[model samples]
Target chain A: MNEYKILFTGTMGAGKTTAIGSVSEAAPIVTDVANTDLSLGKERTTVGLDFGLLTLASGDRIRLFGTPGQQRFDFLWKILAKSAIGLIILVDNSRSDPLADLVVYLDGFAEDLSVLPCAIGIGRLDTHPVPTLEDYIDILANRNQLVPIMSVDVRRREDVVLLIDTLLAQLEANTFGA
Target chain B: MTILRFGIPHLSDPEVRLVKAFFRLYSQDPTFRWTIVEGPPYDVLLVDESVSEDVVAGTVLTLTPVKSELPNTLERPLRSDHLEAWLKKAEYDLRNARLQPQPPEEQPIDEQRIDPTSSSHFKLRRWPPPALLGSNPVRVRMATLISRRALRLDEMAAITEQPLAECAAVVNLLRGAGLIEIQDLPDKPMTMGRAGGRFADQSVKQSFVSGVRNKLGL
Candidate 1:
């Protein structure tokens, strides 16, 4: 009962691993390997999963898990979300179809999303602001979702912290008012 | 040049003509080139005082027959001097607003307060950009509550134990930015809502989450 899990899922280059590593107490265990998909221009890719851990003051631990980014491995998304208390969906705005990438994860976790407090972190927005945050909002609103979304640089620990706090704030408020 | 399009939806033909003619010679503000357009998508809208509904457009200027006490209302028999004065003021305000605005002005008490018993719901159309939300964890907490369901301001404040003004500021700020939308509250309240769906097996205690935040220095 001391362990809780949070899931992070997004497109291949959206920084889920970096986000975990940014806040993890110990080195996060990532299952990334040499990328065969060079179109994304990355030497390594997470094929299985990425794991990080945070040990709280009370001896409790929160487990951070990142699901594989490709659609073929979407099956693992639900499995990883099984006991998750929250979800953080990252979107790489610079991608050709970041909106579509978002849909894949949203639909992938639709069930888990129904019960899990979630936040969205859009990366690379400083340079690529076209599919603006407003654009993402339209898509989410159209789908009847009310999840909080914001731009993030997973490389910045503060941004990653803000993203996590966004999710936790959701849970804290709901639990307080539930 | 940014076009400061004005719409005189409720003006008579003669008044519109006169106003348009005057605007043609208004060479004062280089901030924006002003134009008088027919409708919707207006940056400055002049409406009849009789029209009380909110204009989904920019600064609404009401045309009243006599001097009105409320801000932004112009009395009819529109004097060239008065019109010129108001116009110059508006141009300056609009220019500065675009320069970058702080959260919109505070909401009036009635507008900011909501009766828990009322039926209308308020929800966010989008999360406010980080620029607006900026470094305020409490504001983020308020935004999260709002994004989850159509909670009244009182309920939202209570949920987070934040000041009513603080929560109202967040809501109004987003509302001004067009991120918060007003709609009928859903027939069924999202019990335990999407975010708080109690884990089927257990609930994560508040203390546990706080501890994690502390350990990470959040």
Candidate 2:
């Protein structure tokens, strides 16, 4: 059995760590630190990376790598995106502009992950007054080509699993040329 | 019909696959009664091994039957040598059956040998607090060194209070991102450089101070 590597990349505080912890069967090994960086005025921060190992029921283990979202550490994201089989671009809707956040990450992918399969998770939309999924998709459509995008609570098990399943299906479709 | 029972730890994938294969192959025999008993937070395999005592303490192997006779009591100790021989033959296949982690610091026996509670001088004031952030070393480094203009890996080790390897790992990550520029002042005596050097920017200093404040709640 072969295991695939998946990556979770998004803005800071977008729940990358929470998502990994919720879905990972093993206690997710976390690399987190309180945000002290004044670069983006971040009060809470994840400077290095959040990595977790997930064992699927098929007995194949998939490694989930969560990269930092700050523009200063763009180098790390590029390196991590090289071997990434799929990308989970988490969007924070509670922030003023979801579309702007989407643009930043999508632009980053333009360099390293050209044509890589991506699934956008619109986080914090449940509490915030944000547009619906259709609105979110339309928001993405104006930018460039649209990928499989959905609103997800990164903290929930089912939502994270659904996002991964989408990514796996996309990978299979790509690999088999289906 | 020699029916023997086994108590097994968590079954590995390879072990389960092998068992299923053997079960399917032996299902053709009418006298064989291989039963799987799952109960009480443990899994047991009931096999009719002719050579009962042959099975080792930590293995699952196929047993060949020499006769057909169910022992009246099911709690009989496994005394089958025939099964043990089979285990020896299949031991290679089971090598990767379980995935064990790299040896932990302080082996189980070592932890047991040292009674932390009993050592009055060494007694921990508190269990180490839950990490405020996850175990990302780079973040820890940036969090720690963000305020400092210049930091040696040795200085980082001292600041984080972690071992050299951990400190090196954190520094390497920060250096990779161009967030830090490492200068090797090998000739510097006593590993002493000033704390919070002038090289750090106001932003980096503020970030570092905030991080320390958040972490220490000072």
TM-score of chain B of each: 0.43, 0.25
* Ten-residue region with minimum lDDT total, candidate 1 chain A: A169-178
Per-prediction fnat: 0.45, 0.00
> A9, model 1: CA deviation in Å?
0.9
Model 2 misplacement above 4 A: A1-3, A37-43, A56-59, A112-114, A176-178, B1-218
Per-residue lDDT of candidate 2, residues A88-174 (tens digit): 998888777777888888888876444465677888865873544445544554554545556678777767766665454333222
Candidate with best lDDT: 1
What RMSD does each model have against the real structure? 10.3, 21.7
Q: Among these predicted structures, which one has the highest TM-score?
A: 1
Task: Give the Å error, residue B36, model 2.
Answer: 59
Off by over 4 Å in 1: B1-122, B129-131, B152-161, B178-204
lDDT of 1 by residue, A7-53 (tens): 88898889999999999888889899999997998899998878899
Q: How many residue pairs clash in each candidate?
A: 0, 23
Interface RMSD of each: 5.3, 23.7
